[model samples]
Target: MRWFIFIAIYILVDIYAFQAIRTLTKNPWIYSIYVFLSLAVLAALIYQVSTLGAGKVLDIKSMYVFGIFLTVFVPKLLIVVFMFGEDIARFFVGIFMKVAGSDEAQFMASRRKFVSTIALGIAAIPFASLLYGMIQGKYNYKVLKYSLEFDDLPEEFDGFTLTQLSDVHSGSFDNREKVEYAVNLINEQQSDVILFTGDLVNNLAEEMDDWKQLFSSLKAPNGVFSILGNHDYGDYVKWDSAAAQAENLRKLKNIQNEMGWNLLLNENRFIEKNGQKIAVVGVENWGLNGFKQAGDINKACEGISNSDFKILLSHDPSHWQAQVKDSPRNFQLTLSGHTHGMQFGIEIPGIIKWSPIKYRYKNWAGIYEEFGRYINVNRGFGFLGYPGRIGIWPEITVIKLKRKKPQT
Candidate 1:
């Protein structure tokens, strides 16, 4: 029933768009060519969806789905907007003709080629952007650096540097060379600790099988620590049985351990330098509303004092806004990455930083501070869904801890 509704709407839009194309190019051969190409694109999209079915995971095949949809949908949307506007103008004109007792004047009006040409021109922008996003934007990883000052930070860790990454989404990766390059870039930062805030795989643990070695290559003197994201629990896909799903999660944990990552599940570990220690706590997926809420900050912070300088690794920024900020124990800093800036947005340093997801999640990207505490949301390390990124390129964040100077 849903498919029927979708096809019905899609056909209507296609027909309306084709009519505008016909007006722009009156040649029968050109019209026939456009019709054939449109049908072929639609067929390819339908065939891909049907073939992938319920077991669809992010891969090269998924890219085809996004590509075909953008190719057909963007142009149709532009054409429809122009057609609707022209119809409104024609409606007012018709009313004038009727009032003037010149109803026959309607026969003289025809679809304007300039309007159709303008629609086509406007539609090309997104078409080109999407194409570039798929080809180059996804691999465009940017290393962003931040220097944060804390009044209560441990003096031993004053110059401490930490590298943070999130939303690897290993299942979506198709280019090993590109990923290898990203890993190399990470090593170049040479931070004291490397923290991966989650979405290691899209749905299954097996997704990491191919890239395990590459990711295991990531090194930091203080060690690499990780936490599970909402997608890590195999919750999004149907499992054969409850036991199977549990086993998949166990394997994912084991894989992280094998790669030398301390998979912190509502747990805390201490990082020490020159005998001075700071707490690093991690929690499972804890998103608001529709997402899973498995994180327990109190449980993770057990045995740690409120005055201790602490850093948190949580997958979703909402967790910080909801629970971490007001906790009895003040976490000095929190690192997160679930939002991914919707993998599309414009961020120009201090000038402007905006993404559609900002309306939903206040701390969508970069560093956000409130009530003396801070959260740095990494703009994901990989792409998902759209198989590309537009303006919000993949990010690698490096944060340096600085001690605040006291006023004399």
Candidate 2:
């Protein structure tokens, strides 16, 4: 039923977009090529969707299928928008002509060739962008830096720097060289500590089998701390038995340990410098709307005090608003990643930062502060669902903690 609605929408968009193409060209060859390509994508989509089963995870092939579908569909949807607008204008124009008793007036006016041409020209931008995103933009890593001021931050840890990465959906990666480059980029920051807010794989633990050694090289002075994201739980894939699923999660934890990451499961650790300490509290995956709620913040905060400067690692940003921000516990900074900014959006610093995900999750990406507490939603270190990233490229966040000066 889901695929039915999706394909139905795709066909409608194609038909409307084809009308625009027809207006611009009388050439049979162009029309034949266009129809052929459209049918090819539709057939591929059908084949992929039909073969998917309950236990099947979203693999690389499915990712490309989705990516190709988006590459073709989004531009055509744009064309439909322009053509629909033109049709509406023609509708009203025809009414005005008939009202005036014009001799040659029809129920609707013909589409202008220039308008169709313009629509296609405009649609080409996203078409090209989607292609680029699949080929290169998926691996285009960006290092985002921020210096946060905290009045209660301990003086000894004033210049503390931490690099945060999240949502490493290893199952979707096809290019090893690109992944290596991103790893190198993370190391280049040389932050004091590395914090990974999870989703190490799409589903299976073996997904990281090939890339384990490469990622194990990531180093930081204060050590690498990590907490599970929803995907890491292997809930998306079906297992033969409960034992198998438990074993899969066990293996994933072992893998993270092999990579020198401290797998904090509703646990807390302190990063101390000189004589001052700040709590690094981690919880399991906890998200809103039926997502896994394995995270226990109160349990993780055990033995910690409200006066201590605390950094909370919970994979989903929704946890911040739901519990951390308003809790009696003063969690100064929360790091998370799950929305992935929908893996597509327009973001120009200080100008516009927009993604469809924002409507679903308010703190979907980047930094947000409430009542002096902060959360930095890493734009994700990897891609999932869609094989590529559009405007919202993969992110590596570098956050520096500075103690705010007291004023006279």
Error of 1 at 173 (Å): 0.8
Whole-model lDDT values for every prediction? 0.88, 0.92
Residue-wise C-alpha lDDT for candidate 1, range 206-321, written one tens digit per residue: 99999999999999999999999999999977777899899999999999999999999999999987899999999999999799999998899998999999999999999998
Every model: Cα RMSD to truth: 2.3, 2.1
Cα lDDT for residue 170, model 2? 95
Full-model lDDT, candidate 1 = 0.88
On lDDT, the candidate that comes out on top is: 2
lDDT of 2 by residue, 126-223 (tens): 99999998998889999999999999999999889999999999999999998999999999999999999999999999999999999899999999
Model 2 lDDT, residue 108, Cα: 43
Q: Kindly provide the TM-score of model 2 when superposed on the true structure, using C-alpha atoms.
A: 0.95
Q: What's the TM-score of each model vs. the native?
A: 0.94, 0.95
